[model samples]
Target: MSLQYFAGAACRALTARKDGPSLYEVCDPILRQPGSGGDPHLSKFYRTALGNPALRTLLRRAGLPELNDPARLNALRQALVLARDNPTPDWESVGGPIAELVDGITLQHPAPPRRTGAVAMPPAAEIDRVIRACGADLLGSYGRNGFIPTYAAFNLIGDPDIRGREVLMALQGLDARGYKNSTLMFNLARVFIARSPAAAVINPPWRGIAEPMWEPVQIRHRSAYYDAFFTEALLSYLETGLASSEQTGTARAAIAAMVDFCLETSREEVRGADGKSYHVVTALAPPPHPRFSRFFTQIKQDLGFGVYVPDCDTTACSFSAATQAGSNDPILDQPLVDFYAGYQVRAGGNEPRVTVPINDNIDYEGGVATWIDSMAGERPYGNDLDPTLNLDVLEVSFRNLTRWQILETEARLAFIRRIVGFQQRLVLSGAFADPRAHIYYLPELYCAYFGRCYHAFMALPPAARQAIDPGGAFELIRLRVLAYVEDELVGREMNPFDAALALIALGHLGGNEASFAPAVHCIVTAFGEGGRRHPYRAYEWNKMKTPTRILVGGPEVTSAFVLMGLALARRCR
Candidate 1:
């Protein structure tokens, strides 16, 4: 559709909001449209209009302010100029006053009565059904060599901690399955490792075979791009699982070997114009693997092998290096360095903090493209980058590391604040439009952040917790939960996974039982026939055509998230 079509759709969506328009309502239409699909000139023109400070204020204040009327737009612009020049323009005092229209829109739902203890647990049969459904998905999707098809398998295994003999038996059945790639195998191993250490020692189903296959000798020759971090993480888990000294020794040797191999293949020494030598990990090596670049920076950071040193003022240093590197592509260099430096700062101090400047050079509408270019780096699928998704994953990773004492307290809180800041900008800039009014991806993001926040508050020292505003974070989460309830529960967006995640966050926030009961019931009822499978996508409300299909995590991802929600609920109780 043309820009007008998109703009008109946004306006309709915004004004239709009973609780006043959210920033997402205005941005959703534009975001959903493919970047190259719309009229280039018209898209740019509308972006300029939205970028105008006066027009933006009007749009935010009065929904989409009669964008088609040039006279009204001009009048707003003139008034803004007068206000600037006259310091305090007495427009309110003048007889020719602009009417202030307030909708009195409020999106808040009454808080449910805070549970003194855990809410009632789901029936034993119900829990059993969920466990079975998840197990079936896991077993059904198992590829040869014990690998599952999607990253969701990691979530399934990682999040719930995969207890129960029945689920273990289901996993045991995949022992003979073969992996076509290291990614799948490493993930599969990770799942097994996350199980009880006793289970590994007593029932060693895939361990004997998988351990031999992952021998340092076998993996040493593999490309660093494909195997380094995955191999290291896999071995780390293997060391934890195998109780025997010999087996654990093997795992440790393999880890060291893989680390050395990565350094040899991925590291490059270069002399800058300042005649100083620096070692940095190349994004990829010769004979590139397809998935190489996507994980390059992450793997290097995970393995502790990057030019930027941890715990130093790496932010300034990395940014300086990017400038000195003299790369023709500043757009790519700048964001990549920022991400790298941010992580380094996070890794260095007990309280790691780095600031990522929201580019003012690109207006709100164009920020999406700029964010993609900067953040995605050399990845070919730059346009497909989802800021919410990236931030969610990053926040979770930071939280997990901090919990393990691998990351300092400051690092975890700093990273979380940065992510929250990014989300706040999207809301303020009016770039987070979702016609469904849930911001579509926001519940998931809020769940991730709030979940982390909850755990951090409980686990960190009081002083550390005080450094971050737990109440403010909860307020943001509570508002999003209300939106989720309105759109997904009371309304019909109906994504059980997202709902389940939101439920978990709400429980953590001490949400009143009444407010979240309907959501819990909705999720419980979503259990398909026999509870053997759940639909991969939520059915849209009123047959509304979603801009994109709901992301599929199959049964494994769905059941895992549901189980996690249940687990969280039980904990809260």
Candidate 2:
């Protein structure tokens, strides 16, 4: 329940499902390990012995027949009879040959399998130390002067950031010539690292910043789609981390530049809501920089990169950033509020569609659609409801306080009503764990925002809660959220991906940490021993046209989440 280790990341995991690896398949690498990485009380592996693909593959390849039960799970009551032996071989004499075969033979499956040697899982305490150290190295070594990636691509052993869309290479002047710069990572990273315990060990990365960060110019929705909230994160960064530093004035100007980029580029449109039309910031504002003038503003016209109109995702985040940066402009009043508020799906109207690969959208009407234009227009996009963005809207609606409150009373209440309505839809439909109910973000990322919202909801006074919800609307569902996380712990602890999300959810929900010691040890020992975990696909090929799926995010951000979970675990201990 400690707010000190409350984990937050504006991290995104985007992908358009093109059918390659399931989330479980990506998790196959570590789950097959021989022991509970070191805890003896726990099982040697997360799942049962029959499911260890690598071991079975190894046995098959060595010309030894595997146990051929219907489930491949058998107990040898008499003895392990290897009939291939010329004569009866003693157990002691056969050890060397078996050890030699099993030591480092490569497995065919598991995508990029590791050539593991004699396994001695690291002790629990050692694993814990390694978890902290890995987090330390991730932040201190790379995060010290680097930008976090939007997609945490799990390229564990291959070349790092293989897509060439990284600011890290751009900063280092490496081979990444056409570096696809991110609009939000630097600011987001600053916020995450600063808030985490890692800040105590390393110097602030944005200490000397004085320039407005660039818009997400290189990234194309139709043209340069902008992200401004990571800028707000930067503003939060400068105000909290370096207010008295000499770079304060420069920092403000840099922040203003990005905020202005968001403001000036917003599409001012008259949208109808509450039976009236209001001029709101409809579209994401690209930077006014003339260098990118060739990029088209009328997004519907461009058929090349697929049409990405203004969405609740961008509008809500951009509006939140604007409010935080001290803007009292009228755009924050009716137009923007009503425009977004008008988009939430009406109750009982969400028809089932299987467009996204993650989950079924059954009875999701209260949720907000991804894009404003509902594909009826010339531009073909919309009808997809994203839980991640809904939570983002919910997060800003509360702004770390109890009960959703923003904008004028009438519009704000209307907005909060729909926001809460969609939240109910997500939980009741059982889609919250399905990649945050979409293909673009991980369940972990969704939990990160959900945790914040839950924390804020808990802050409400009892009277205030009763007045708002009337009948304790969220009380039963809150238990559901906690139970869902606890259910995950009951299953086999797979990889750091599951562990990270489970630990963070429990921490946010104020659950007892002692209940999930095995999973915690799994995370600690995985890092303590192998010292390797690539970014598993948090999201997939969100592009309009692509044969193969494209994943994002790097190991550095992956390590940060692991570290965040470890921090909370340490506090509980």
Candidate 3:
């Protein structure tokens, strides 16, 4: 019998065996007793099949031919067990036998064909209507800085009413749920608040909503990119106030606290058990206190954010000569010597420094965190991870600030521009476009970014396209990606996430006219054969069914760009 039949019959055998030749027909059973047949091994295997439909299908399809030899079943079962270890598989490694069963099923039960032809976009009037509607719906949800119960009293409402007392309450749950990326929300809100006419006078409800999420940024051991949003938000807040006479003093004080924290916590000077001291670098470079001082000076004048460190100011010194090894000697290689002199050295003049390749400290090895840890000191990993104010941290700290003194409209606009500018230069520049362009054997959110840049360009005047050519830029990028996917080195199938993003990009670049047929062809081929059914609609695609849950936007890359693309298509249609 097939495994499906055997499993079904085996289940039936527990009761009502008299009705059928075997225990095959027992769909509806009359239970005389409470207990089960209780075959532990069979029960375990049955439970496994019930729990995993994909496994059951593969196993059932294999049937008696494979299971007749018990060892093969055992081997298959072991593979199934190992498959569970990787819940979200990286590739199609677990699909050899499963593919056979799936293909057989496809032959037996033909599925419906996929839709083709240009999907119509809503008209310009409709898009404007929706955009206005969305804006109106969202406007009421925001306050100066944070969300407040509609009923909160005046003191609870605090200054800049958006940020005041309401922010403190929201901070508790800011990162409580799956919303781990509160920093983004906070900074986005801060930008809006700094520039918003209403928000300048009061914080915004989203500010309070975003503050507590900044807790992780103080982790000096982590990359500086983590807290970049907070830094931008705080800078925006300060600059906005600086432009206004009323709130400038408070903004400067906040900025000072942030700069002080960055300068103090980022340096690593520690004393070993012996009398000797060890000095380490922890920042992008060494302590830029003087540079930071100048940066603050410029900020005090309200110039704007710029890179503080041009080069490492840490005392440039050489490693001890005694540590050179056979062929692996770093000292022998001048480039390597220059790069890692501080991380390597001979302990004693006579003793060989290179006994083994391992560095002195195992836990805090001189990897990415090494430089930052050196600046932060010995208690880098533990609770001593500065739980205080950097410019970013101040954004969170001031989240608890109930009253925010309001400012003028022009001041607010300048504030947001400065923050966006800071983020653009310092943080977003590294991640401006789709990062997936670097790695795409398996596709990600390239299409998303493609859509965004396209949307932005399309929104500009038709003449603007002549200069910016955002659409053409996206087309070139999309072509490059298609080339990479077709490469022999990347033998990966496009999942639904990739397909959705690709469709968006292609649809945007292609538009209503048939001029974009080539891009459209790329999308269809990536997902299906001649717009027929897709072969692999596996779990990854199933998980991607909900847009909000799959990723912050899509796995493609740039959120701002992708959002813009989707919005533009929706709007322009």
Candidate 4:
């Protein structure tokens, strides 16, 4: 499960406060309980690395205090809290002393300085120039790697949420050449082509002994899920004639790879209700996280070693892009709508088994399930459901169905109602801080996608819009997210990525040009001001278990999102 207990040791080793994720946010272990049969492997050490005597002995020998040293941990935690409240121009380092756990892995630039202040918004013409420049940034974001690459700090803590555990790669973002050239692979397979990471990553400050996840080689992983979203964004801008013919051609070819991946990786004979079977797209090709073998990820999907299964989020994104590109339209081949519809949890028999606290009050009668595989190889698989996945499925399904002129269908209504129910019980409830919200995303991102779909639907004729969202449910959610975006604009400290998401959500559904100015003013202050585009991490870690979990994204996707927000915001006012 979660080796979160190790956060203390990691923090202590890094000479960080015995509290917080200064090193790595209490890490989830990398080791899997390997086997094909029933749940195996016990031992407190497997559950929490601190329980291992050998590891504990190392900590003790290294003169590290008890990991459960409550008083000291809380003191350190409070110190960090105080430091954050009093951030300086350059975020002053709070680290105590470096603990050299691994030789040759000495680090620097792991923690980025806090970005504050505001930048003047450019004039309309200048904004256009800025947008074009941002577009260049977006295009330049794609490296020799053919797609956006995700960076995990060499420290095992996957997400590295800097709020508590801050570290930024020194050679982050694009090099002097105007594209990211540095990537550190934990896997032996050098799938991505980039420069080796400098000795300079601020490794979780090591003041004492710390254990690292001893993961083996990883396989070739082209993140088709991420590519689908980026390709769709590129495809949209391609119509503006912004790219050179050669760049356009290159863009088209990359789009082809994503389409091919989605089509080829689609799992066949996936069972629906009553012995019905259908072809379906899964999140990953074979292993969701190529850091592990197919055997490992397969078992992990079954909660064998990981938290996420082949879920509907990847399916929605991949299928939506493919549909937009006119690649593979398999909706007609199988009972596509019917297959997805059957997965919807009903009030009683079909209702999702409410496992998460967020959905505890909401009856999951019409909600969509996240994981798609109903069964695999004589074993029951697939039951991780969430409300955001419903929004994703609903919007994509509506858009794709409308595209094919298959608007009037029971399944369409089901998808629409699912998010309606979600908005009522979840968003309106202001329980937005639900722990599960960040399971797969930083909460604000859900708003961006929700607004994206709403924007598309609103652009249609009034009659079409009415027919699509007659209940005005989607409108309510849109307003809720829009209001949230407007509200976030005034916050003291804003995550640049969250601000980018806010700009996106606000841009899609129009309020006023005035509302957009503030966040944009704040965001650009951190956007490549003095020189190169620094990597402002989005803090995306599944924070769940599985073979190996690494938070994805670097400056490429961040720049792409900011650029998209800026470009789309132009249509406002």
Which candidate has the top score in TM-score? 4
What are the per-residue Cα lDDT tens digits for candidate 2 across 397-504? 654232224433665566666667667767766777553245355544566557656755677666645544554546655676777666543244345545655666
Worst-scoring 10-residue span by lDDT in model 2: 175-184
Residue lDDT tens for model 3, 228-325: 21222233333222124433453344334333233333334543223345442233323333223343444322211122221111211111101101
* Per-model TM against the reference: 0.38, 0.49, 0.25, 0.65
Better of 1 and 3 by TM-score: 1
Per-residue lDDT of 94-184 in model 1, one digit per residue for the tens? Answer: 1011221111111121222322332344564564455444433433433221322222111111112112221222222221111101111
**Candidate numbers sorted by lDDT from highest down:** 4, 2, 1, 3
Compute the lDDT of residue 555 as modeled in candidate 1: 38
Per-candidate local distance difference test: 0.33, 0.40, 0.25, 0.47
TM-score, predicted candidate 1 vs. hidden true structure: 0.38
Write down the RMSD of candidate 2 (Cα, Å): 20.1
Q: Please state the error at residue 517 of candidate 2 in Å.
A: 4.6
TM-score between model 3 and native? 0.25
**Which is the winner by lDDT between candidate 2 and candidate 4?**
4
